[model samples]
Target: MLSQFMVLFGFFALVLVSIVWINKAVRMFDRLIGDGQPAWVFVEFTALTLPGVIGVVLPIAAFAAAVYVVNRLSSESELTVMQATGYSPLRLARPVLVFGVIVAVMMSLLAHYLIPGSLSQLRLRQDEVSRNISAKLLSDGEFLHPAPGITFYIREITQTGELRDVFLSDRRDPEAPVTYTSSRAYLVQEGGGTRLVMVSGLAQNIGADQNRLFTTYFDDFSYDISSLVSRDVVNLDEVAFANTLEMLRDPEAVATRTGTTYGTVMSQTHGRITAALLCVIAALVGFCTLLVGAHSRFGVWRQVLLAFGLLVGIKIVESIVVAPVLLNGALWPLLYLPVLLGLVLSGLLLSIASHPGVWRRLMGRGRRSAEVAS
Candidate 1:
């Protein structure tokens, strides 16, 4: 019961820490965009995203907390007393594993379903913000540089989506400068991009020998002012989410267009399976670590650090295994190696914990050191 409480408490604490840390990291990038949005907007964004981060961090943190709590109990000889009262090591490990399984199932749901849905919503919100210029985002008599190489200067923006004393300059062309002026303009989305629907505007072109000018008096005109940047086309299957059954079902249509290889697809599929298995293996590893180090003088912090290191190492190995599938098709089997290594390590830790000789040696070492000091 105590072990279960420790696991639950640790999961929540670690998840909260992960949310704050990730939010802090994302804000640094958000500030660069100069959106003039409040910090609370970013905080809300981070809060909505906490589940995804928790899904990834919870399993590992639960593992570490279990190890720390169990090891501390054993080191203080509390576990010894429990054993004297007929509580077996396996019996102690059961509650920890049960807690780990519940966390694993929850994380699996987040990773496979909830995270993707939240990410899609985030994209839509960003798109809405980008395409629509809110009055709140604008300040009177201040130049706004919302997108690269595009600047807008306005004396005031009215509540009815009208700009006064507006000046627009687009420096995308170095050889020829394009300058435009309008008494009023409104924001609009066209052709998957944002455009300024300027009315009663005149455009001027500056050249070496002469200046070319054009004036238009129309009800409405559209000027391309899109801020959206094109991204490099990476193979979709390389991403973990694309490996889902729903995605794979329409592979012939979607897969070929994504520019991904069969090996890359296979690796991504295996990676998801491996990730689910990792939760179980981490629990085993944590339980064993606690039991083997039961009599150690080191505090829980050391075990926490060690568990974090192990989790990081496992993630690194997972990436390394997937890299081969991206580079060479023949090395697809290498993706399985991380899961195999995790299993082996978990088994080894369990063995070390169970062996009578190993415990005897550890106890003997403590006795010898005490005797020498005496």
Candidate 2:
């Protein structure tokens, strides 16, 4: 059973991850390709995103695999045969527990190690790509808006990399809209930033208050292009980039370094730990829920819905607890409520499955009472 669960878990994980990753990759592909980036860059970005996706979907896949394997076995009467052989529900659950533990280990590796590393690398790559302004702005004969309220157009580019017939419109300051035109422009690098040096350019400013125009001509002027294409500075000391150990060991230092509060750092750290335990809860809940049902030739769709509802209940508890925990570091233990609820629910299901005859007797007595009343 453990082997079967492992195989189906792998299959479900692959299918789900591919579906989600492709959706995200499609949007990223358009953005990167539209910006004149290469195919390899898109591939690299998509690859870096896979660890985070897998971390989210692995527990779900584990639950699905357990539910499916048990449903198939029940439909085939294999579970009935095992019960006839004196195998208890608790005995049957041993393999499922093992499978859940294995998946929890995988989730642990991702939550503590792989996800943070990949996120940090992705941020670094994004920083480098965002600052590459020449690729986005150097195209000639087309109007480009690098940032909101800024329009730029270049008529031609020389073999020596000089831009000709430059047109720039800066409406960022709505009260004083400005436009600049120049016969030629040269890109200059100074102080680790790129500047457009326009020779013999005319600057036009329109005052919205008085509806008046002002024009000025200069032999040379410098325009800042780096600021237009640059993104928010990536926080090198982001708390999420650190492992859970580092955060827990010195939360004060981590909070100070990342410019965040102790509550936020502690929440992020404990959140990872609870997330791993959720995999175990999900699998146990799924298997135990299905085991509560009797033998049926048709299917156990009702039990499936019940299992889903239980999972949703767990999520509701999680959503209710997370906010307070995030606001107050002392409430960090609230994050484990979901896992505890899941385990308690799973145990109840197993107990009901073990003594299935008691429920049938109670139902029969109720029917007799109903018939007498009628």
Candidate 3:
């Protein structure tokens, strides 16, 4: 059961993560490739996002595999034989517990190390790519949108890398829209900044506030384009990308970089630890729920549905707890409630399954009373 659960979990997680990552990567290709990035850049971006996808998929996969294996065993009567041979529910759960622990360890590794490292590298690569104009962001005879509300078009490119008939539109400031057209232009790299040097050009500005148009023609012109694209790595500093140890050691710094509260950083750091525990809880929940009733000849489909229901309830509780915890750090401990609830429910279900006599007697008494009333 343990081995099967592990194999199934790995398979499902891989398939799920691949589908999700590829879907997202397709959307990214539209933006990144449209900005003139190469195909390899898209591949690299998708690769860097994979660890986070795996981390998100692992726990759910473990639960699903555990439920499927348990249902199969119950349907096959193997679980009944073991029970008749004096195997308690708790005893039968040994393999599942081991499976859960193994999955938990994998989740811990991803949460603490792999995910953070991948995200950090992803951010750095994205920042570097965003800053370099020569890297991408230019194509002849096509309109290029370097940033929001900013567009550039070049009619032709010369052998010496000069631009002929260049047009740029900047609407970053909604109150004033600026348009520049030039007969000849050069993209000059200087002092870690990119500048558009235009010769024999005209600048047109439409001021919405004044409701008027202003135009200027010049022999020579220059526009600083460093602001058009992100030039610094700071643009990539999100809380999800920060190291767990770093968040624990210096939450204040994390808050500053991520534009979030110190409490939010702490919640995120501790949330990773708690999420790993939930993976174990998820496995146990699936395994124990199937032990709640006697073996069914029709198969354990009811128990399978019950197990999924329990998992959904636990996830709902997790979602409910997250908001309060993030809002106030004082409520951070509540994040473990869902895990605790799962563990408690699993223990109760296993206990009941082990001592079916008590449950049978109670049901018998209730049926007898109902008959008397009728």
| Best TM-score among the predictions, by candidate number | 2
Q: Candidate 2 regions off by >4 Å?
A: 139-142, 145-150, 155-165, 169-233, 361-374
TM-score of each: 0.69, 0.82, 0.81
- All candidates in order of lDDT, best leading: 2, 3, 1
Greater lDDT among 1 and 2 belongs to: 2
- Relative to the true structure, how large is the alpha-carbon lDDT of every model? 0.64, 0.90, 0.85
Winner by lDDT between candidate 3 and candidate 2: 2
Residues 22-131, candidate 1: write the lDDT tens digits.
Answer: 76557744662356455665665665567666666666666666666666676678877887798766676677677667666766777677766666565555554445
**Superior by TM-score: candidate 2 or candidate 3:** 2
What residue pairs are clashing in model 2?
Answer: none
Candidate 1 local lDDT, residue 103: 60
